[model samples]
Target: MPPGVVSMAEALANVNPDALHSTQTGYVLPEPALFVTSTLQRQRMFLHHWKLLADGFLYMLGQEPQLLRPQDWRAVLEGKMSGYGRTAGLQELIRPALALCDIQTIQGLPVPVDALPQFSLRATQEIIWEVADTSFRFEFCALDKRASGKQWVAAGWAAMALDERHRYVLRTAALMLDWTTHCTRSNTIHRVADRCPWPPSEMQALETAVCEYYTTAFYEYFGRAAVIPMRLDHDAEMEDMEDGEI
Candidate 1:
């Protein structure tokens, strides 16, 4: 009931004990998984199961994408990317993408990504969209010989859904008014972009996608709507899954 934090007991109380196991058939069941942060710890069990498909047809011989760069995505989910790191606010979050796009701004603009947020939004777009699709629910249930590739894809959306700061900044960016974005300190400025890089609907969709997967994860792992402590055997299973040996 708190503003930001949801305790495990509160999270559990929301889940229906008698709900059908939806992992087998997907989470189209009546009782949906609670969309809260309580799944944060439990979801780690399937952190290895996250992934994406490139161009909708880039999957080769059924091989999934590799998690080449997971540092930024991992750091935030683990609560490591919040404070000042080289740049203040969320500038650190979008710094890597800036380099990729060759878009150089001042040394430390208050929110460089704020001006054109797509540079940051594109970081997690395709992969999150894929994993959230119902098709991969079973794939996550199975892992190939390479599993690390999908971590960042899942991590990208999880950061948006789970981290308070990350979600707040993203939602704020989406709600920015046209005048607000174009204005100077005092007077209104000339025209900016005809439209923002990305739309608010994208933010809503990302949250919806992750929240659905968050619920599906509970059913897939716990076999019930409940989220309890994962056992040692499950931990070992997750370790093995991470190695793509599963």
Candidate 2:
């Protein structure tokens, strides 16, 4: 394999926790963040490996690394993994899993949330409050609908080109991870405080939190401002991107 793939493969091989325990639900990985700076890098690598890298980061957050197939996220997050519970009962994702970690505290969060091309400060702020909120009064039925009026869709890349989607999600995930690192396994995703679940499932939510750690790796290589930003309208713009509107 070429050096880039070799190094990335090696890095993925190195993404394990400090220790293991039957008593533990998940662990905080201590490795630095590993953000990918260019769309070329992603285009070169195999998608499954990229996904494993994604899952590995999720595992670092004490979440179900199986983002597409979340099984024990709620039980683990809610502290019910030790006993029998329903995996499909509350199929929503929250944030902050644990183990050894290369932490990026929320204190140094960048001023420009518009760095990631497809993301908006408004959307980021909305989810931050949504995930942080602990009240049933504002409870959402699904992760996709958790944000405002289904207007600011988190997965707004549905119609974007594959390459564009990869670039957008990667950077957006990184920026979010950087800002929310302070809340890892230490926040209010508690059982009684409130019940906030991500639509589709908790996998997307957990996936967002987990990306924080891996995005650090990108910063180590390319500073934090690498992911370019752009303003977009969900219905009008994203659809246009698919039709080569941009």
On lDDT, the leading prediction is 1
Top candidate on TM-score is 1
Residue-wise lDDT of candidate 1 within 1-246, one digit each (tens)?
112123323444444435434333222111112212265342332221122112222232134322212333333223333456632543443434344444354333223222322211222222233333332233333221012222222221122234363454333222221111111111111111233443545544443332333343444343544222111212222432323222
TM-score between candidate 1 and the true structure: 0.20
Where is the poorest 10-residue window by lDDT in model 1?
181-190
Spell out the clash pairs found in candidate 1: 51-150, 66-149, 67-149
C-alpha positional error of residue 100 in candidate 2 after TM-score superposition, expressed in Å: 49
Could you tell me how far off, in angstroms, the CA of residue 67 lies in candidate 2 after the best superposition?
34
State residue 25's C-alpha deviation in candidate 2, in Å.
38
For residue 57, model 1's alpha carbon misses the true position, in angstroms, by 42
lDDT of 2 by residue, 116-187 (tens): 123233332222222222111111111223212243323422223434644443333333322322223213
| Candidate 1 segments exceeding 4 Å error | 1-17, 22-154, 157-198, 224-246
Runs in model 2 with CA error above 4 Å?
1-199, 228-231, 234-246
